[model samples]
Target: MTDGPIITATGVVKTFGGLRAVDVDKLEIRRNKITALIGPNGAGKTTFFNLLTGFDQVDAGEITLDGQNITGTPPHRLAAKGMVRTFQLTKALAKLSTLENMKLGALHQRGEKFWQALIPGLWTRQERDIEARAEAILQRFNLTHMRDEFAGTMSGGQRKLLEMARALMTDPRVVMLDEPMAGVNPALAQSLLELIKMLPAEGRTVIFVEHNMDVVQEISDWVVVMAEGRIIAQGTPAEIKSNKAVVDAYLGAHHGEDLSKVELA
Candidate 1:
């Protein structure tokens, strides 16, 4: 619905030893919409996510967020700039309390500096504010009861929820989720799906790597298909479902069979 992309990348490339993991020529993520990035196992979807979010360096390319060049910016710097991401495997701090982990996602904490932290007057009010915000988010994710529990003690699906909730602690403009549904149980999966769908309505753009076509079709406004480290198709979910290139990307060896039978990752 927005006039232009919220995030754009040109000539992006990432290499590992002799292999080029990602080689996206150009990509645009629409503002305030959910865009699903779907690809096969070795198609480099996750690698591309890393390059875009600054979790990994791009060998060559320019990445821009809201028209500002952010190429090679570090993850923390990117977070401060309103571009935050969650990992395929949830990255909740194992030993930290759930509340503590969420609080860590808040940027520019006065208590982080040694001298400023020593002065309770300088940071106490802000710390209270952060705690209040974290508590509210935990309640939204249904984790308020576990606020004081160690993050490592939670189930796989709960950790995923925690990771997503923590990313919002930064109040990001664009949230990139990598395989948010992987390992999540069905009941929790549905809740995650609803939460993701609600993000754009709350004024945040979402770009996610998902393997489930059903989930992609149900929630995504747009879909980008990738194969062998390159994007081959982009369109609405309906268009992507019918695109020959997309079908072939997923079922190259079985192209002669019914395209509907092809299971897209």
Candidate 2:
């Protein structure tokens, strides 16, 4: 295993309208592992995401990636440093072709300058290499055939796949997904689940927020359960399944008693 956690949060807190949403005292994302963030509605998972990604400012806390303090860096800069995330809803470019959308991700890459190309052979070659890499990624996602199609014309599942493919265009170390299974068909949901599971195999720290317990249990190596804007439980999938607090918060306060009574009767 790697030596450092890919992401860490200490005393992360954020509030809106005088209501505290996320009260995670501490959180850690270990290197090269699949971590699931599961929570009930209104639990502030998205709020926490916004703060950590710089989409929202934190009132008090610290967030670090790979031991580097990146508490308040804007999203673009954070992405440049290999911290990237996919939206709960696919925010793909409606008018752009899928291939063009992937190409946009390569614009921020190093060594693509006019000066670098003035060498007569280097920069042009690198640009061409980027195109080839994008093509390869599209193929990997089974999107090569749709590369020329406008993003708006694709089905929701295809768009989700495209979004995931686009995130890879940045060569990130940490990939965060906000409900990767949302808006996807069952077949595509299965595919998305498999893809998320495969993320850590490639050495990227995978953290995803999802409410679908079946998908979470099938794919996640570690589960973090949040409720009422606080992390109430963290454990493996099986452990999370039996967590009384998680059941009460998500299912109902009487969930365990009902289940136990049913079992005994």
Candidate 3:
């Protein structure tokens, strides 16, 4: 039996003035699967991400998540709907303690009431549970040591890790990551890769934008290739490794960029 996709986009289009940033014909993120959106610079990968996450409106087309049409839902609404995304640039709450920042994500978990804000018992009941869960998450991400530290003091990769951990605090169904490995040092990048690998094990849907072919090959279950605001190729890592269009897009005739010997692994 085949399960329906967790996220689906069809005929999606987005234009910025004279430029068409995203023109994907169709893209599907399978339930509990890891999908990578890969492409060269200016491939429209980020634009597609924005459209799916509702950071920007779509020019035309449809987006369905878990059987509901969420085409133009705002980012905050989507977060409440169990779809949370992390940016390519790390978005740690600078002044908040690592643990406190994660607590904010948990506010989306059960109740977010103005009355509950005024009443002590309503929220106090869950505070212990929330704190336990948050600590567990930080431990899982190997960030327990920095739980009480200010988020601003951590390294770039640690902040990225914290971001991913915070998103999980909502118990999200789909995690859309925008270039999770960008600008990360090699050592921490590997740590992030391991975390990405563990995401599917936790039964969460993982979709990410990335330029690192090795990381893409390591973590992605399905690959979608985009170029010049259009999807040009998509397949498994091995298949994409040998595809002509992908090759042309990355290393065309005039560029003389030979990557045949350069293994993503």
User: TM-score: which candidate is best?
Assistant: 1
RMSD of 1: 3.9
lDDT of 1 at 20: 74
Output the number of the lDDT-best candidate. Answer: 1
The positional error of residue 169 in candidate 1, measured at the CA in angstroms, is 0.2
Q: Name the 10 consecutive residues with the lowest summed lDDT in model 2.
A: 256-265
- Considering only N, C-alpha and C atoms within 3 Å, which residue pairs clash in candidate 3? none
Listed per model in order, the count of residue pairs whose N, CA or C atoms clash below 3 Å is: 0, 0, 0
Query: lDDT of each prediction vs. the true structure?
Result: 0.91, 0.84, 0.85
| Candidate that beats the other on lDDT, 2 or 3, i.e. the better one | 3
Q: Model 2, range 203-262, lDDT digits (tens) per residue?
A: 788889998899899988899887767788889999989877788778766533432232
List where candidate 1 sits over 4 angstroms from the true fold: 254-265
236 Cα displacement, candidate 2 (Å): 0.2
Per-candidate TM equals: 0.93, 0.89, 0.91
lDDT of 3 by residue, 83-172 (tens): 989998899999999999888888444346776777777777687789899999999889999999999999988989999999999888
